[model samples]
Target: MDPFFLYVYRKLKRKCTKELPSCSLCVRLGKTCDYDGAASEMNVDQQVLLDRIRELERQLEAGSGGGTIAEISAFPRQGSSLVNPTYTIHRQGFASNLYFLDPESFGPAGVPATELDPGMPVPEQVRFILGNRAEVETVTESYYDTIDRWFPIVSRKRLVARLTTFEPKTDASVALLLLCMKLVTQILPHDENPRTGLYWICHQFLMQVEGAPLLSLTLLQATALMAIYEIGHGIWPAAILTVGNAVRLGHIMGLHDRDNAHQLFRANSTLTGREEERRTWWGVVVLDRIVTMGTYDGSILTADVRNHELLPCTDSDWDSGNIAPFGHAFASDLTGIQIGHWAQVCQAAHALGCVQRHRVDEGHAKNSRLDEAQQLDRTLVSLAASLLADMKQRGDMAINDPKQTGSRSSVDAIALCCSARFLLYELYACNDGKSNISRVSSFPSGQEAVMQRISLQGINECVNIMHQIALRLLEPQQHSTRQSPESYITYHAGSIFVTHALYWAASECSWIVKEGINAAAARVMGDLVKALHLLNDRWHRAGDYIKLLEREETLSD
Candidate 1:
């Protein structure tokens, strides 16, 4: 978008001409005109769009009287009250954000704080929140600052605004959304935290809300948040189940299909809604693919969505609600395209899906599998190079810019690259005696040696990156008594997002150490073991990695 027009629309309180070759202002100023930004409707009257949406929604609710949700399919049918709830699109600027409010710190570790009654009535839950408004605001703020910073699925500004109103009580979906955020952000060190008591409360509420006839955007967002919480806390089949719920909901809502969303909205929806759906879908994709990595388990994601979806806007554009239209970017349109950190992560997740679903497994020729694997290897190499280079250039991972979505830790997006590389090479890691693709010990030939060399390079880079992260996370000569793994993730206590990537790298490292003696690989493994040990108390996946690494260490002995 034109900076002048954005300022004029946002600050000067004027309508935007939205001219293509520069607005009249730019033409008069004799500036090179460009209007490369968010939806054309953005600079227009947002209230008008909201009013239209509200009217359409009212019509929808009126058409469908009332019904109960069945089989988790909340789609509306003829004469059914199961409508899609559209919360007021968050276009009210930074007032949507509560940064100006006095943020009282509300960590879960403390007692003698405002607490919620577990048996509070469904509608009465909002009262608990209103009574403890400061605490609610603090935890929501913490979510944006830590967990949401790197893997932002929902808008903190929108949630903050929703919390201040009656929406939570009126909308069961909104209530579930708030519960999921509080569950994730507040319940740390799960054993002793009083908020852990709310886990079952939240889960039960989710079960009831999931069956609601009205499938609100807030419901989908809630499921996604709950999935993140379960995944991060290493909650077993619950994590898998929650991820499936979110992914299936995203698919049912046609979030993966840009044209489908357009059809549903029918010309009145703005980029704000599209961007929200985009981020929510990508968040589910990241979770879905990451969970299924290195496992035979199939992905809940349906047909490849590369050609059908638009990647999220840049971090700054997304935060300020300056999101461009779908024409700005499509997944297929972005090859080696440097857009934003999360966009790159989306691309990486796509690569992972490609690796898992590669043609190698089909009853094709060995040469076909080999050729496709090489292509995948090149894709990952290019991807890892782009992400690592940008991360190195960008410098700090603390995210000093206030315009930034949230303060992210170092492992925000880069770890997925390592994971993709390791996964791509895992099938080829078998002995050359058994397979022609791998030539680690046996004599090398033309194409096989070249592929082997590339595979080893990718493998080594995984260790190199993991070693760098472990070193960055663990200070030199610092007292190593780490009862808290969250603090060990970054220089400070940043939320953990990529422990699965760490586990994958450790598996590859263990294979390396078990197969032969690589001094550098072994040293990296040591750093990883120390880091994993700290993380074990928090994430079950990390603890598993520690055991796997130790078993490899024993074999090396």
Candidate 2:
């Protein structure tokens, strides 16, 4: 693209004889050449392009040789815009900014001043987190059975081993235990306010051991779990901080550097230990992508980390009581059926990030962007196809099977598939810029009609899937029941999923209404409202959706 600009600049600068009021070149080409004050701005744009082109050429030349590329860095630092800055694309004619990767800060970090004032000993903290022996057994069982599948970083066997020892007061161990108990005590179907006290103590413990001298695998695991717990509770700022810390610690320990385990950790590290670290690192990436959805919070796991290794093993492989050496990449012998839903979620996230990076580098110029979006759409479709095929091959996890429907991981994989499709829709549909509710203003006839068609298809699929998810949320056996707190972290990604789809539908309601799709739009809205209402009983934030619908109704009235 830069080279093309340079070529145009060179052609424009060439001296040509004038014929009448126009330049000679214009006359020879039978075209108009009315250069005015705008020519100076064109020259400035050309100069910027030339500089960028030269830098890229230098990087290319270095890559051709033995040296590394000068432009691309393996590990970008925290808050570095170059890592992956949020790109804002203006709607061709609308007032709202179309953001691809907008940064989201949850505000200031730390617990209440008074809350941090008092510090209890590890023994008291342990007892506070777990009241009695029976309570300890219950919390442990609950976490392993219900919550662990989503982010299986902590080893149940290892944790049980630690518990058997006398008062193991490590920061990571304590943080992990506190967070698990907090989730169990808070998210279960009940109206108990007693556990918030335990949640605060856990927060205090995390703050106390935050700046410990040495970094351990356990600490990273704890930090990742803390982020997950905080995000589930709608504590965005704290979740952001903990996830950031976890990613930073991961980089320092070279967790993402492939095949460098011995160099970073103990020389005698077992295969199981190495595999555990890999899963934990990937878990952080999953949480990072999940929590940062819809906002421009730059992802903690950069492309560099993703390229470093293969995904973790299947649940069956991990659960089997066999010890074997794991490879640096996904095993070719393992069929797609063996890959877990969590791995599919990671792939979806990675694909979304790639699309975002492409958008940032290349502005929303219709021609190439449509092609790229379609290509990404194909890739995402292929991923979904693979997941479906895998599910069929397994037989037990059939798409419509009642048992599979209850599995949180299965639900998450399907939701993420919907998310990827919506991303494709948003990429192309954003530029239409028509916001008036009275007319079908976007994707007017004859302008990139192919893109408009693809985007419309994406929208249709997204809305349909949203309706399915809403129905699933009403199921009696879903993890987040009417009586339980909304555990958005586990299987309840529907909260964010529905909100995103609902906003997209509502924003375009005027256009759809004008196009005689009012009935469909109303149905989508009704389903979303029903799902959110189910959550509203226990999750305070769910009420926000109800209020949004009310405002829309008022506007209509």
Candidate 3:
């Protein structure tokens, strides 16, 4: 009956049958019937770790006099089981560090094992539904061919390397990731979409893995892929919840600290796992912003990316498994910088966060935020310069590959950047705000009108940008060679990851049609909707996007 203990149980996701002394579940597990006693013992070891972390922090602060410069050394990373973990942290110069998450203490998992396959040769049920070994190989290859090129969250070579050491019956994390890859890549019937089949299997494994105290990069990648399924299918609330947990894991593992001054040159200065970690964090950030795009809500990426948060490593080097870091950070000066495709996507998502942040700003009137908007627009323009140039030379579909629209492998990044600018412009210009737009002006005159007029111009430019992207998506692919061949990937239109960009543009332009601002923009929305219809076969959420636009069209009519 003690609510505190009940809350703890709920936080740990244990269902208490309300049995006296110990809940039925606890009774079955032979644990103390909690709530009425010193139930804190349930997580006493976790507290010990926390207390040790605090002590370490205090010692670090006292030693470094509050400096954030970490002493770079060849110590083992957190979570490794060591009889004695060593960190040569004390150095000749300034030195200190903050442990976002200390490694898990050495112990078997508190919960039971969740065997995904449950057999040496893979269970008949799993093998029948998912596939046999060779079929699984095809599905896995398709995953890399389809989503991974754009999302680039999971490392294929790394996963193959890791799976080589994993036992088939065990290794739930890898299993979950593989299942998710199949769920997204393989075309299952509607009954097998979410709860009825593969999605359900992955969800159960995710719950088990997410519960067992939750520490593992493999699980993080697994969650991201599953959440992609959720977002792609328009599975609300659940999508956001999944992305939120992934963000939390990202923060806990210090994935967001890649370029942080405190975490620099750490991880033994070898890019061993750092490349995957860096790419995963960017994927996490992009997904966090993307889920909110469906509702035109604020981005969920709470981690403030600094100007120095280096963008993802070069695409070419990453694919070849080279460990060289990218040339430049998202450093404030983004002028004429030649970055990779995925880096552009990362920056676009980061800027979308900034654009969405404007909606939640309550300090000043919307008009007062014009300077912020202007600066953001300028930064976005600088980023889009190369993309626009590429589009100019090569028309809409840059490469012969259908999935790559704007400028080959950079299609999703181009889409995201266009949506960012479109939403930023529509934030001030569009009359409708509740649905597609982020905000509507309460005070609709004078300086507000001036801002709206300026936003209208920006919106037009965004429309022009959207037109090019739409043409790339809507127009048939040409067998031309004006642009270099994209041998790196060959993603078809059916494999585009998130339709957030296409959805966002259509939503805004639909309102532009309703308001009679630019009737020509209607064509652009139609083109985007057509593309979404083509993609609906793959994601199904594209259908949701089309339905929303149709509703608007109906209401306007």
Candidate 4:
């Protein structure tokens, strides 16, 4: 036996006070565990473990015992340190310090994790991950940039008139309506310039389309539900603006128009079948009316205070039985990108409303319709919470499913990243009394403490999810030579989403909760920014490649 092996064996023997064998790495690493292997293999493992242990020990000594190895290795498993001291195994003869571990080895039960193959060069593997992330970021940036650049140029008046000419059959009319809404919403926020008048003209043109059928109950319900979330977060201004537009459109189409508009609005209201949808729509309409009423009285929306629960989801009799279930027109799987818009709107509302909760039915005149709005708000919040929970559960199951043994699809990969970001926001935004309620009430000390706990939990989850995503994107899989460009694009987009989500979350925390985020979150944001810059460089390079390919084909022809 090698002398080192003999020394480790003696140490293990001394540590083994019972019949069960002791782990060599634990003994050498100065932790506790079980070891079952040849002495040389054990020695090799111990040396690796010892290197890490020594590094940690030095860190602890430098920090005057304030820093611990336990803190460094806190993730992937915390309490189980005694049983699974090292959850990962680095590839044999690989000089780099990267470790490959089964995703299942880390975290709470049922949380998702990604597995990495052991053969690839660690540096190349990391680059591969970064490349995918870069691609996603590039695509997202392009999408935003395109929207920003072309929006000012789009002729809203002509577009609205064009929209009016097409009286579509079936449920497609909602698409046109939504398009009109999108144009207005995007332009309305920046309407100070002279060019904004064109948007108003366009808005007027769309409003001229009488009896425009409310198509896609799913979309209306989704939008309404999102509005409720905003109201709950005390982002009354945006909630008012968005829902007010919907109400104005509904009323204009319902009451003022000469062409069967009232019948169409009635039909649309009746079509929403889900109890949740009915509640959300009613809540939005009632709230819109209340806000309008208050504005008419020259009072703030928050000035009125009544019990919101009086208006329950069941208050509406609008024949919700007629609404169809979600269909092919709506995207399946609820991509994070799609849901992201709703989250953004909700956050924007929160910022405008001073992060306060309000009583739903207080101070409204008789038949004020505020009760319906409150019910809708509650229902939408419940729906969002449920959706988030389901996504988390599904992600965990998908990761562990025996049949899902192959690499993840680009969509699924991106979805996972989005889901993680969603959870992070929930951690900061959801259930925080200070952030959730209206300004009339101050958060108690206990509530503040709870909010901090929730933020910490969310931060921990976000960091872990980010790590898993990074590993999956960067690390090589079996039988694949290099990651596809699509993978790069997806990863890049996902990283951008994560970066923006963090920035928004941090900003919200600083503004509402006053609980400063730790340095790690800031560090992660910095890394993501650097990653974006790198990705932009890659995108430019890829653009060159594409142009070269096109020119080559042209020359060949």
Q: Top model by TM-score, which number?
A: 3
Greater-lDDT candidate between 2 and 4? 2
Instruction: Quote the lDDT for 282 in model 3.
Output: 84
Query: What digit string (tens of lDDT, one per residue) describes model 4 on residues 188-251?
Result: 1111331232223222322222212122232343344334333322244665675655555434
lDDT against the true structure, per candidate, is 0.57, 0.51, 0.61, 0.32
Best by lDDT: 3
Estimate candidate 4's alpha-carbon lDDT, on a 0 to 1 scale.
Answer: 0.32
The candidate, 1 or 4, that scores higher on lDDT is: 1
Model 2: per-residue Cα lDDT over 348-452, one tens digit each: 656656655654544565445556767877776676666556655655244454233334345456556666576556655644455211122333445456666
Off by over 4 Å in 1: 1-131, 190-196, 260-268, 325-328, 331-338, 397-406, 432-449, 476-497, 514-516, 536-538, 551-557
Q: Name the 10 consecutive residues with the lowest summed lDDT in model 4.
A: 74-83
Q: Tell me the lDDT of model 1 at 166.
A: 38
For candidate 2, the per-residue lDDT at 179 reads 51
Query: Model 4, residue 529: displacement in angstroms?
Result: 4.6
- 384-420 in candidate 1: lDDT tens per residue? 7666666655564322221211244335466777777
How many clashing residue pairs appear in each of the predictions shown?
4, 4, 3, 30
> How do the candidates rank by TM-score, highest first?
3, 1, 2, 4
For all predicted structures, in order, the TM-scores are 0.68, 0.64, 0.69, 0.30
Tell me how far candidate 3 lies from the true structure as C-alpha RMSD in angstroms.
13.9
